[model samples]
Target: MLSPDKVSAHADEDWENAGAGDTIDVERLVAVVRRQWRIVAVCMGIFAILGLVYILTAVPKYTASTSVLIDRGNSQIANQMQASVAAALPIEDDASVLSEVELFKSDSIGLAVVDKLKLLDIPEFTSPARSPISMLRSLLNFRTWFASDDVAADDIDTLRHNAADKIVADMDVDRIGRSYALSISYTSTSPELASKIATSIAEAYLVDKLNSKYDATRRASEWLQERIDELKQKALDSDLAVQKFRTAHGLLSTGGQYQLLSDQQLSELTTQLIGAQADTARARAKYERVKSIIDNKRTDAIVTDVLDNSISNDLRKKYLEASKLEAEISARLGPDHVQAVRLRSEMAEYQRLMFEELNRIAESYQSELQVAQTREKSLQDSVTQASSVTAAAGETQVQLRELERTADTYRNLYQTFLARFQEATQQQSFPITDARIITRAQVPTAPSAPKKPLILALAMALGAAFGGAIGAFREYRDRFFRTGEQVRDVLSLEYIGHVPAIDAKEAGSGNKDPESVRGLQNGNGITNYVVNHPLSAFAETMRSAKIAVDMENTSTRCKVIGVISCLPGEGKSTIAVNLAQLLAMQGSRTLLIDADLRNPGATRAIGRHAEQGILEVLLEGRPLKDVLLLDNKTKLAFLPAVVKRRVPHSSDLLSSSIMVNMLDELKAHFDYIVLDLPPLGPVVDARAISPMLDASLAVIEWGRTSRRVVRTTFAVQPEVMQKCIGVVLNKVDTEKLKLYRSYGSGEYYYNRYSAYYHEA
Candidate 1:
């Protein structure tokens, strides 16, 4: 027993750790699993059966596989031959190998295989077998509703394309790890067909590669031939232009030298003119010196040329001797001596002869100067003529050189293209590919799909997951009181005890006075259960309720306790009848009143035979003693509620001054007054008269009544909740209740104390 404020404070303290509800609780989870295991098992069994059915009905498909090795080196020979005309094939890498795998599964390869194998003729290939699921999908197709009836059927080409697409769709191509080997697999209903298609795919891929290479080489060869012919003609034309230009310009070369004849002549003339100029300068200088000697009569002056002349030297010598002889005769004799006169004449003759020799030398020097000057002038004229011819040829040589360069370029192109054409022809003749089938596809003996065990296992797992989800949802929604701990923790009210549900058969059994039980309308034996079996658990729970009432109202002589619940069907009426009986059986004066004017469950249970009840006493001013029905064995007085019609304002009637005074009068004669009030959730009668009541006992259906509804009921009727002494969990299934037993809860130790209680 606890006051409302103390209970509220205690509830708040319990709620301090309410956030912990969000965390995972292992024991709670185990309890939920234990309670819901049957649901999970049923769901799993259903799924497993479905999986088995699917496996049995599904069509078997055989997958045949073949391996193809991509040998890039196989094409090296062709690559080398066609290197000039075509680019080299790419070397195999991870990406390239994967590209090959994709190519193997390409529509082109599929189409090629289809055509070679004449797949269009085969019905299986043209119109493949559809699975049940596919057929069902076709049946449910929404597009068919909108489609026109005049839609054209597929033609032969379209059928072929469809067959090829089907082949590609069913084909799988995978490259082995980090290798150039590709695994080609095909799935089909027939093993042979699967093997044939897989093998055909590999062969078709190789054939496609070969055809591609051959076509490329053929095209390259034709192009190279056209280029080679064009270049040959261009080479010939360029050579002809070079010769023609050389001839037009008269730029003739000698001895196979590139230099023109006019240029050689200019060079030779320039050298000769330089030598002639030098000779002319020397001759002029000699001629001037000799003339000066002759004119000035410088016989005493020594000239190299004059001195070399024999006559001049002889004449000079004779003159020198004669002068010497003249000088001696003049000095020895007189100036007019005859011998001196002869010497003088001889000297004069010698001088004249020397002068004549000097003149001759001068004339010879003049002749040599004239000859040298003439030669120099002739050489200069030749050089000037050659320079003019060479200058004109130089301008023409520029055009000749350009024509020669063009001829050389065309010739080189022709040779290169000619070589490329040969290589292209060779490549076209000897076509090669990089892919080859290393392992031929073989027919598979076993089906590759619809693995029974794995599918069943997966189905079971899926079912378990779905079941677990449903169980979790149920657990999330299970916000009901299942144990006494829930009542204490959720509502913060003292937990009295749980009343086990009594079946009708068990309630009527072991009763000697059937008429007396019938008169009290105790067919379920719930109203007088404590009188029949005081040692039973149900009767014991009543005692606990009585104890709670007595504890809460220790100061009062008579405790007026109202038995209420949040909702109907929670056994509040049964609880009130049993509690009153237990008090009366224990030698305490007890009065059981059915104050629930709306439903009157207690009146229907134990006072159904009474003609008048609490309603008659209240509205008609009837005496309470006249309407009271007393149990002879327990001496418990029962006040029934008889409603002739609907009572809409039941709460107003229950809270009236007449009702309060009636209860006060009954309390004077009874030690405990138990009133069966209407559930607080649907009516306010319980809360309206709660001010006059000493205490209230809340009866909650175990695992059925929601904790939220009870809390809300109390929240709306705080006065009733404040006077609430304790809560009794009613209508409990003891077997199932064990699953919800938490540690430190009353139910957790129910088994240990169960030996003390027995039904009569």
Candidate 2:
């Protein structure tokens, strides 16, 4: 039984505060003891024997560990930015340590270590003294995996990988519960060897990291130097290209820069002057046309065309007027006359004026053209000055370009040189990494396995568990009982009494060779409750319960307590007789009634003569007093159930109130009565006989009555199922009780029973 206090204490010890879990898996050592006791026993036994074996014949290994602190001296190192310090130390980042870890696991590092130790060429370990288990392990080793092939590149790679893998495998690095420190440990049959291996691994890691940094920096310096040289050459070539371009172009000193600028200015002025001269000529022509338009209201088309053509517009106008006068004279005076002479003179004068005017205009036009040519000459001079200035400007531009090319070349070369120098100097310094050893493996004096105390304790507990398992299995699987409680619990009936399941030697009152009713038990008779303690509670309880039941109903009659079962051969007949005898011994007028009409058992078991009985009296309509059979020795009366092949509807006969009335009549004569009925499961005879009984009881064979079949048997009779008060479990083995007490059985209170139950 699990008590609240014990369970709570256990739960608290386990710190089980989780709200009741989805499923309670309380494997309280108790339940385990009750359930898997065998498994626990076996496991404990194995461990114990293993301990003993370890103590006796097993080799004891002593561990010797020495500690080391991988103090990556973080605080001791100087920071680069703090120039106030004497020396600026390189700060090592976490990445550096991780890198070292990876590199330490590299094949190059591992192979170097292996070569130094000469482990690579060590032939396969083929020792004759190897254990079978060890031999099996070696058989699956790498050498065997590739033993048949020639060494190849892939093989070499695998070898290197495995070598590195072995280093990690052999060395146990513990930073498990620690920080920034590695405690490396190695175990070997030789303590010194383990220490050496651990030390070597650590030293190898630091050295490898340092070498890698130095190599990387050295390579960078070499690359930078090469780049500097290449850049210098490129700068020189670019400078030469610019110089050649200048020489071919005839560009002199930068004085020509101004000359080219001056030429550009002159070209601009000349273009402007030419435009102005052309505009002046166009304006003069337009002015003459406007004057002509002013002088004459209408101007002829031919006059307009010839206005600026080496002739003045005024001359053309006078000539036109004279021509008009001559036409008038010719029209008025006929051929010759004095007036014609005067007009000719005037015409001559006009012609002369017109010629003079034409000459003047031609002169003026020529002058203007001459002036434009002069101005163009002046612009050419200005262009010449501008060309000089442009030359100076071009030369200055060339010099500026040359200077820029030189500066670019120098800067590029200087940058490459600086990079190379920095790399070389930094490489020369070879700054030590910031990482250092923190915690190292500690040497232990004892091994952690094969504890002896734990072994012995486990062994004792194992034995008890083994015994309990055997007992529990037997308790669940076995069938039958030989005690009163065993009978009452299964049948749910008040136990009349227990008549122990006896061996053939002490057997009495049962079938096989029970030849007589008088003094049936053999010599030195059976040591049964019947003979040993007649006044025991086992018998008294039966009498008391029967009395209580009868008194409650207040019916004093020969009502029968039917002793029935689901099937045959369950000691029911024997119980019926014993019960009647027990009642008789208690001075109750008891009658043992046998109602198994089809097959009579009482006539043989009791060895009583059954020449006249209940069957004969009932069917023949005879008086039942003549049918009463008395046990010759005990004061118990008996009613025999006759064996007859021709026994009519015996089930109906048993149920008829005629039978109830018959018992009612006999109740006046008898104090107690019992009926041994046929097995009620297969027949309805018991149900038919229910009215004839005041009370009833049934017996169950303990473990053999499976849950399924028990229900099957219980369903056989309605009255038997409904009226059954208690069950009787039979044939329990007592040996299991002792083991149970040691294993799963707890301390019980004896005071509860000590007052009432006296040991006999």
For all candidates, the clash counts are: 0, 60
How many clashing pairs does model 2 include? Answer: 60
What TM-score, over all chains together, does every model reach? 0.71, 0.52
Among these predictions, the greatest TM-score belongs to: 1
Residue 385, candidate 1: alpha-carbon lDDT: 92
lDDT per residue as tens, model 1, 205-281: 98988988888878988898888889989999998988887777666667785667888888889999999999999
lDDT of 2: 0.57
Q: Estimate the TM-score for candidate 1.
A: 0.71
lDDT of 2 at 481: 42
Write the residue-wise lDDT of candidate 2 on 449-513 in tens digits.
34567656766576656666665675556444434433333433344332224344434333222
Clash count for candidate 1 is 0
Against the reference, the lDDT scores of all candidates come to: 0.83, 0.57
Supply the TM-score for candidate 2: 0.52
Best by lDDT: 1
